[model samples]
Target: MTGDLGNLRYISPWYGGGMPPDPSLPNRRDARRNRDLFIEHAKATFAEHGVDASLERIAREAGLAIGTLYRHFPTRVDLLLAVFEPKLRDFLATAEAALKMADPWEGFLVFLEALCGAQAYDRGFNDFIARRFPRDERTEVMHDRVCQLARSILSRAQAAGVVRPDIAEADLIALLWANSRIAEATRQVAPGVWRRHMHLVIDGFRAGDRHELPEPSLSPEQLYRVMARLGE
Candidate 1:
């Protein structure tokens, strides 16, 4: 009902905004079973090794042939999309809720906390959020949606004179990149250290008595190039 990927569906009865599964795929029960197995194993492997995890090993662990994996995913992005779909939907919902909060400053904090918390555990998701997949329309659209929501939350706070007016979406993205590295370095040694850093960063975002930043925010094209480089 929604292009070749069926209708857009709820992630569950409680949460919504999940992506549709491909309708072009086989409907046979065995085919569905294999797809489920591949997804389950892939989620774990990606969590451990990021999106570039060995496909061969994932296939072997799923108890399916490599060909079966190729048949379903076709590319690493496809697998990444499948693996992260639910989490992505959850994040979008959180952002939407943040946008609706009465206190713009509180909403800004809520949104940033959700964004950073997502990267604290899964390495694959950490990489996923930081990089840009320019060649894939699906991922591109997903990124666009994220930026849209972020900008809305940011502008709302700026309008309320809570967050600094100079703050941009690119600055928020920079925070995520910083959090990713901090998370990797300190996750084992100090699991909650990233939050401490995030609070400091959040303090810097407050409007009053803030000194001007020395440089302007990154241009959209520059930001795109940076994210593209991360993927490479």
Candidate 2:
């Protein structure tokens, strides 16, 4: 229970969800039975697979037409998002809650860990729109919300004398992106790099802005594309 939402093992209703599925969605009266069938089977199938899981299998299990699946989910990621349902809302909620913690260090820990987990799940955090999907309105909204939460947490942490007073929210977001990338690259050969770097980062932030130097945050997508082209 690291508070990770991606792990379906902890999704309660999903765990108890029966073989047919939950009959809560709005299909026409004529399609109710089959829609419920699809929902139930899709839930189990996606749980077994992931965002890119087999739609054909889901349709087969749901006993619905493949067209029905596409009608319900215009894209795979949308279906993925629906799996977690409140994944974004949960993220925003977590950030907001971190702001109210009593200790600056602990509050910062909560914030850092949340961003870290987001990165761990995908190579991008605050970056859902960069994929094949159209611009995610939720990304912009979540960005602003999380940015405010980060600012509030940092301001409080600085006031408590645990963080550097001059560091801004943009700085934190950039650090999050950088750190997440680091974790992804190193998790295989350099395990625990994420936590180790977090300690190093917080140490720098706590050093009264006197650290020798630090990585300047850049656009991860741009960096990724540039690196991808080097091989071609």
Candidate 3:
């Protein structure tokens, strides 16, 4: 990964490097070129505007015609949905890549950090997405993907005798969601307190099912609602 872009995850020579040429991007690269360009800018636009960002703004930023944007996305929701797919793919890819860490616990911690980062940043967007399209198939698929990946990691740690045998996938996801809450609450009080709580939680998780636990983590929907109220 480092060899490709030297730890700059967002730099894609194919998608994000720089514009190809004027109007000639096609007859050159693969399909979805314009769509990829739209996704790149849309993410930035959405970050600033939440779900209210205009398709016109996205197309202007991407230097594409509005018709071209609609040709690919068809609807604003389609564009949002498309941009979200690869964003999450990047998220899960990072977690899976962390499995290469020499220490199981360290890898697990990094995975938790990845989750925390997403919650800190994308949780709002995620909630907006949920409200926009409750039970979206893509979101459901992502939920299952995350759940399965966490379960696999838990199994790995348990097999290594470092994690509790009874630790379910739900437990880790809850922990990540909880840590995000702390991060949101104490962001002004101190930076990285959520990271601190994450380490503490990890210690408890490693201690396994024998230990008393904090409150169960909020469901994804509940977390979204809580964060929305926090924003309000």
**Clashing pairs in model 2, backbone N/Cα/C closer than 3 A:** 21-40
Inter-residue clash pairs, candidate 3? none
RMSD of each: 10.7, 13.0, 11.7
Q: How do all the candidates rank in terms of lDDT, highest first?
A: 1, 3, 2
Candidate 1 structure quality by residue, lDDT tens digits, 116-217:
999778889988988999988998898889989999999999999989989988999999988878988898899899999998999999999989899999
Q: Candidate 3, after superposition: displacement of residue 213 in Å? A: 5.4
**What is each predicted model's overall lDDT from 0 to 1?**
0.89, 0.62, 0.67
lDDT of 2 by residue, 1-232 (tens): 5445435534544554324444754546546666556666755664344344588888877777899878777765556555544555777687778887777789888887777666554532224412223255543454456656777888889888888766766567557657756876786797577788876776778835475546544454554343234212
Task: Give the per-residue lDDT digits (tens) of candidate 3, residues 62-180.
Answer: 99899988888886667767766666687789788767677777777777777776656554354442332433565556656675677666777778888876566656756755765
Q: In angstroms, give how far residue 147 of model 1 lies from its true place.
A: 0.1
Q: What global local distance difference test value does model 2 have?
A: 0.62
Tell me the spans in candidate 2 whose CA falls farther than 4 Å from its real position: 1-67, 75-77, 121-136, 189-191, 207-232
Q: Could you say which candidate leads in lDDT?
A: 1
